[model samples]
Target: MMRLFIGGAVLVALAGCGETRDGNKPTGEATAKAAPAGWNAMDACATVGTPAVAAAMGKAVTGTALDPVSQPDGLRAGFSMCTFTLADGAKLTVLTREAADGDAYDAAVAAARKIGEEFGSPAVDVAGIGKAAMWTARPAALQVFLDDRRYATISLFGADFMPDGSEAARSAATAIARKLAS
Candidate 1:
């Protein structure tokens, strides 16, 4: 009887210790979001836009080659990333796998749209990255952004569709997008 009581007492004591895997204060879960492995980041606007399209007022926004910019902080060794700034100041990020044929680019675009949709803020503009071979759906307007294997792309336009370009914003977006690209 005495042995049984001693064993039960020890078990109770151990249970009270609240031990965890790392033995720390037992944080619930990691809040840091990480992208999947094997993805490269690219710029949003870097992709070759479609041949021709009608504007809202029945005009055309011709396709233009990507204008690459320098982003010192956005550059991570062995990783791809990008950023975008909407005229409204909403920031969008794209990360990793900007290669023509890679899942990271597709996944990043899809993830960004998912986030924007979840936000449910009508003001938020979410969009997909990539050209014909690898396009993803995203919210329109605001600041269109994309990141791929090559570089990060950032676009700025007001509610009136006036272009507001910024090299600095693009760099910042690229850095953040690279981190978010999965």
Candidate 2:
């Protein structure tokens, strides 16, 4: 059951990276709002190296890539992702996006919930991370709605993975979100 949740979450997260039906990338204006005053969208990867992340992994983490992956055509400019490789070959990924408004955030939450329902997994409401967050049990993934205009996801990949409620993953996510919010 746990493996199924993790797998489903990973698939959903990956699905968000594909081109939209229109085959267009999102414009900067569409995803530009909600970034903290000093937040540099391009430097999102740097923020993943927080002590919280280190503490969560219980080992040193090395960043493998800091680049933008394919995004839904409607959100081309609104998405960014960073990945780090752990010593045991596990992976930690942080994905950020710019939403248009509350509607958009709501849509994202709904979509995530649907994914969980499809797989017979439940999405749990998580407190104190952002404006709102949904933790999917199957995939052990955390999606945070930082505000109407911004949100992020934290995911872990590898065998012997932690659940979405794991303290380490949650703490690391909170740390990264704080950096992005700043």
Candidate 3:
């Protein structure tokens, strides 16, 4: 009887210690208001969620991934990423990273810019988003400098649903980038 009571008490204790912030699980769910700061993936995903993405892209969001992928970005660890599935059979990806230092930040920025321009320079510079930003049309990607300590990006595949001009995508990406400028 004593062993049963102790086991129940331990279970209750463990349940109370679940991954959460302010009594709510820190997940990529669109319903989350805020994510745990310590959990980079959940935080990044939640910060730019359904309503924000829908308003920014001016499209309906069909779903959002509640489970996020957190891993080392190669240059640095603690990188987290999330995705939003739009109604037009397209997907929007958002990622966040915590750099080990300034050099790592520079390396990531350079790599992003290079990859962004790989297909060609059918891309344009974006202003007022971060330290620097660029939008590439071929693959539908936006890379933001964010700052010396941070960076962010929003990429998409099959973005025909975007307005005729690229302004909407640029603005939407800028808004999301601003949120990621940690």
Best by TM-score: 2
Ranking by TM-score: 2, 3, 1
Better of 2 and 3 by lDDT: 2
- Our tally of clashes for model 1 stands at 29
Backbone clashes in each candidate structure, one number apiece? 29, 7, 0
The global C-alpha lDDT for each of the candidates, from Candidate 1 onward, is: 0.29, 0.57, 0.54
lDDT of 3 by residue, 13-96 (tens): 222111233334332222222323433533566767678788777789998764344444333334445678888877777755
lDDT of 2 by residue, 11-50 (tens): 3543443223344533222443445664443444655554
Could you tell me the lDDT of residue 182 within candidate 1? 26
The 10 consecutive residues of candidate 2 with the worst lDDT sum are 25-34
Candidates in order, TM-scores: namely: 0.24, 0.66, 0.64
- Candidate 1 lDDT over 126-152, as tens digits, reads 334322112122222222223333323
Quote model 2's TM-score.
Answer: 0.66
CA RMSD of each candidate after superposition: 19.5, 5.5, 15.1
Query: Could you tell me the C-alpha RMSD of candidate 3 in Å?
Result: 15.1
Q: Which parts of model 3 have CA positions greater than 4 angstroms off? A: 1-42, 66-68, 71-75, 159-165
Once fitted onto the true fold, the runs of candidate 2 whose alpha carbons sit more than 4 angstroms away are 1-34, 50-52, 69-77, 100-103, 162-175, 178-182
